[model samples]
Target: MRYEATRSRVEDYFDRTATKTWERLTSDAPVSKIRETVRQGRDQMRERLLARLPSDLTGRRILDAGCGTGMVTEIMAARGAEVVAVDISPQLVEIARSRLTPGLAARVTFHAGDMLSADLGRFDHVLAMDSLIYYHAHDIRNALSVLGERTQENIVFTVAPRTPLLMMMWNAGKLFPRADRSPTMIPHAPKSLSRELEDIGTLADLGRVSKGFYISQALEFRV
Candidate 1:
């Protein structure tokens, strides 16, 4: 599959929204009555993710996969954790670099390359925030294998949620309607994901997670 094509489409789509969209993503919920209405859903999701973080993340070396626009990277950096952030979009890399303060940039290294290609070194936590969803069930399996080669501590997986095909298609059009705009090919089946992890390089197991924004799952691995 032409993964680069899909990356190009998503980068362009967000570039067009860089000014407004990125800020909306990075900031706290607005205070005004009307403005607060917009923050309800995603704000809740972010809180859920925050609550789910491993309790011992402080001072840990972390990998922020698909650290688009660096929102999550900056968060981890603020927590005083050493973070290496990566993304496939050069445009987002540029934006993230420009947006980061020098002090924050010092602790967090932002790279524009495929996580599948980059040797980002070992990290206590490997975070794939809304990332692996772009690839197929097998491609995600392959990515997990690559992660296994790198990190031995734990792997953090955050997806756009797994849902029925009809709902997934509706979401593709509603949330990400760019070039191909449809995530029809990305597998959301639980057994497929479990099987991919089996007999592979990493020891992956099903784990507990609070679901929203398409039922995010974390497959913690010890390699």
Candidate 2:
């Protein structure tokens, strides 16, 4: 249950900060501003992830794993995709459901649970977003393997960068234990992540987004 503790911590953190987290991801403002910069970085990362998906999602089945507030889930559902949105935080899941239009709501199913163990069936595409940041390397591999099993086509996700500068900052942030309540930032290298996905029969396409204290690498794994 090593991951269980991290999962519980993440769930509690998101539950406590769900509204602020949603604004930080969905807001639009000048990037020169510190808060806006972080928001824009997350928005950019999401845009880059969506870019790898099919332009027309009509009838496609997608699993929005760790779908905090349903941002991606709503977008995909609006495009006519049937989406299964799962999150560890019940609070976030409730918020996500509330944000959906009635029509969009019908197209999406919301589940509160760990993506790695969710019995949700297969999908044409699986999106993990920034969810994997809670996991260490071995747990990440396990999660990716589970995602691979459930995905028929692609899996797109984001992870903190493993570079020395970023790692130093990540470690420094840990010195302030309050930040520890936030998701455990287990930074990941693209090369290492790619090898992990390869073992699951997927090839990775990697991209980076940096803003404020957030620097993440987005990986799109094609099956």
lDDT of each: 0.63, 0.80
For every model shown, what is its TM-score relative to the native structure? 0.72, 0.89
Q: Give the Cα-based TM-score of candidate 2 against the true structure.
A: 0.89
Q: Evaluated with TM-score, which candidate comes out highest?
A: 2
Q: In order, what is each prediction's RMSD in angstroms? A: 4.4, 2.5
Quote the lDDT for 168 in model 1.
Answer: 59
lDDT of 2 by residue, 53-134 (tens): 8989998999998898888998999988999999988878887888788878779999999787647888899888899886
Give the number of the best model, judged by lDDT: 2
Q: Give the clashing pairs for model 1.
A: 161-214
Candidate 1 contains a number of clashing pairs equal to: 1
TM-score of 1: 0.72
Cα shift from native, residue 161, model 1 (Å): 3.7
